[model samples]
Target chain A: MRYDIRFSGSGGQGIITAGILLAQAAAIKAGKNAVQSQSYGPEARGGASKAEVIISDDEINYPKIISPDIVISLTQEAYNKYAVDLKDEAVIIVDNTLVHEYKQDGHKVYAVPITASVKELLGSAVSANIATLGVVNEICKIMEHQWLLDVVISNFPERAAENNTKAYNLGIDLAKKVME
Target chain B: MEKKRERKFLQGNDAVALGALYAGCKFYAGYPITPSTEVAERLAAWLPKNGGRFIQMEDEISAMAAVIGASLAGKKSLTATSGPGMSLKLENLGYGYMAEVPCVVLNVMRGGPSTGTPTGPGQADIMQARWGTHGDHPCIALTPSTVYEQFSQTVRAFNLAEKYRMPVIILSDEIIGHMREAIEVPLEGELEVIEREKPACAIDEYKPYDNSVLVPKMASFGQGYRYHVTGLNHDEYGFPTNSAKLIGLQEERLIKKVEENYDDIVQVEHFMCEDAEHIIFAFGSSARASKDAVLNLRKKGVKAGLLKPLTIWPFPDREISEYASKVKDITVVELSVGQSVREVSRAAGGRCNIKHIYKVDSKPISPVDIEKAVEG
Candidate 1:
């Protein structure tokens, strides 16, 4: 079955980059086919950024995100903007720190204290994006945790690698228990 | 040695795609539209299987934009559309013309100023093909009268596009588009296909838009050759400028490239005009009726002949003038009320009487109409 995953947040959050890493893992690492497309307005930053990734074993015809199976929102702006478009069976994952009380009626919600966890683990909230990437991997089970960790190491430059690794592991451990 | 073969049964749109593929077109970007969708469908299925790429954009504007983008990435790109879609693509076509990007745009014209007749054909876009896009930029338009010419002229379209570094339009109407006829696609390396000339000078000495050769050298985007391109009037460096002299020189250079090379770009077909007293100016499917009309008029002792355009733009102005001046009466027939008739009138120059036999009911001009026009 084809699964469409979308990562939506403000432009600086690396939400689109998270989508790209997932697509690359599915397409290049696992030998499956994937297509990733992102939408950002004319603004350089601080605007909404959304990246849609579709993974399938067969050729993909339609690339647009109609109803994503997994919708991850790192901010309140993204959650409120895209929550209504989710599939009935979709799992809506939101950051508890950025999105305090927003919830959808029929969809299951997984609230992770992503910003607070990243700040406590990595000594900064800047690694919240990497922490969310780990949460996404744990919930989707599309890629192994170790493979995602390797993806993070290879993706980030040398100086910031340790902080990202610490934040990512903390997110994976938190999502493991929260999803249960 | 094997036999040299040329036969015919193919639709004009398919022939155009075949010609483009044979000319090494590795990329095609287009949105599907009626009467022209087959070209995109065929390319979408064929290009990817052949190691090329195909993209269907959200609209014709994006389709044309992606085509220009792909061309900048060093792929020989093309797009096909009918009337409404072609209208949507004009803005991008202007950008392509101003940037001097080499590409081909096939307009398989249907009846319209709007969505007139989706399935029926018309040669009405003749004027639009020349001046549809804004500004005084030069354009090369080829009108193929037969499916065989559709294949051959498509190759010519690519050659002219690459040679002049401009978007060349292959204007095939519904008649040629839908009409299926047998056509032999020559083997690869048989047809002469001319690619764009690359820079011969050293990197430091090269100017991407240099007027020295009248044909500037182009470097593809990924080729490490740095160049800037914008739709504004600019100097040799491809920077935007408002200088009148630069604008004037660039405009003249654009026209001179096509005008001076019209001998290589313009094509026409003449039938039984030797000592004929009357002539009918026609193109696209209308020319088919004009051909038979000439036969009928000859049977009636009218001494009439047909002048069919294979090269619609550059208008065959001088050739039409020389040929029409020899005839006493010339009747211009088209699916439109009267568009190409203006060109025929100007070419005839009042030295010969001009008559316009028009049909705007979205039907092909019948030979009887041409005969009636000549008799009147």
Candidate 2:
């Protein structure tokens, strides 16, 4: 089975990093084939950025996503730009605090306070990406929760690891509530 | 004891940098450009730590010249750039060819003409790689699609340059350069690394431009073997020669070295072509889409196959000609408007119909694109 996931947000929001971590969890921890790619303007920040990750049981030939199976957007602009042409059954999770507008066109759409929750808990929205990863994994069940968390911990520095861990667990809880 | 191969998730440009280190490349001189800048960045951090030299040259021309100079001084050198930078390096690249300096030039191609798209991918440099430099000079270029091939082909690029005694170009695009994938990094001593043949004769008897052998033994500039190195056509003794016979022989020998060892220099991957009637001819990242198209077509019971050239230059004429005779038609897919298709047409020689599916809008051609072209 092939699953293509896209993460969209403004640059410097770690959208690409979230995509990479998910790919790493699948490829390295779960022993699956995965490919991750990103597209962005030539800016360090504030421009639209999107990253796509393909996880598969078989060899991946075409690297880019033809149609994403899951879409995660942190900003309304990013949501409107990439949420189009998604698969009919595609799962979309958008940040409720930042993205207030989205089409719920016969697809599973969850608007969670992703950035606000992280900011409330950790005093900053820096770990919103990790929280989003947690929410996506909980909803998709793509890999073992511990495997994904392990990959996430390995990516960040030591001092920031604790807060990121809290953010991830918070995301899982948020996602479970949404499913409930 | 079997050595362990470490698998790591690496970007394509980072893989190229690591591959260069594995191939014993000790000098890197490059000017930064998008899509290809990561190569220089990684080398800048790693090259010095590994006891190698890295220089961020002021401009692309100087970077190319510095690489050629470093290689002439007995170091395996490399330079990375995109399209405009590639254009700037062509003049010095030709010098590397004429002077027989062994170095690698990697073009992680971005969109074309003159700074067309700084961050987008393009294969327009396909023709430029083959005939970018002036004159009847021979070229060896490799196009790798996967991150693994990016690493392996880069090592191969260095080996080809050192073995052939000329500049080798790696035509990678932004997608392949920036994309990240898991790859099994070869263990040390696992891959064959070829060093340039050093002079075995007396210092005075060494001929920098020796035609007695297809590839003459090279001596380091400071190794007490003094010889002239110039872009001008010179004789065996490395002296400027106006003699028509010597100049003619010089050019022929330059071309003959690559042509004589064609099999050793050219590589291609044939997927599902055993009994296939239709073929998709592609290279670089476009080949990845072609592979997907072939598989999808096969599912629908169509006889479609993929012929991907890992070695882009020294065009795989022999392979194309043979496939043209076997296949009903071949569709060439590239990111450029139409660069490699002309070569595909020339190599097919009308034995099979040649079609083209190309894109220049900075977006990669998808499998659907290739499938539509083949079916239509």
Residue-wise C-alpha lDDT for candidate 2, range B35-65, written one tens digit per residue: 8999999999999999899999899999999
Per-residue lDDT for A47-82 in model 2, tens only?
788999999999987888888999999998899888
Model 2 chain A lDDT-worst window of ten: A97-106
Docking class of 2: medium
Question: What is the per-residue lDDT of model 1 for residues A1-180, given as tens digits with 9 covering 90 to 100?
Answer: 678888888878888777767776676566566666565653557766677787888754234466789998888887777665778888888988888768656887899899888887667788887888889888878877777677777778998788888888888988998878
Residue B14 in candidate 1 has what lDDT?
78
Each prediction's Cα RMSD?
A: 18.9, 1.1
Top lDDT prediction, candidate number: 2
Compared with the true structure, all predictions reach lDDT values of 0.81, 0.93
Candidate whose DockQ is highest: 2
lDDT of 1 by residue, B214-332 (tens): 88888888776777889989888888889898888888888888889878888888888887888888887788778878887898889998888888888888877887668888889
Flag regions of model 2 displaced more than 4 Å.
none
What CA RMSD would candidate 1 show?
Answer: 18.9
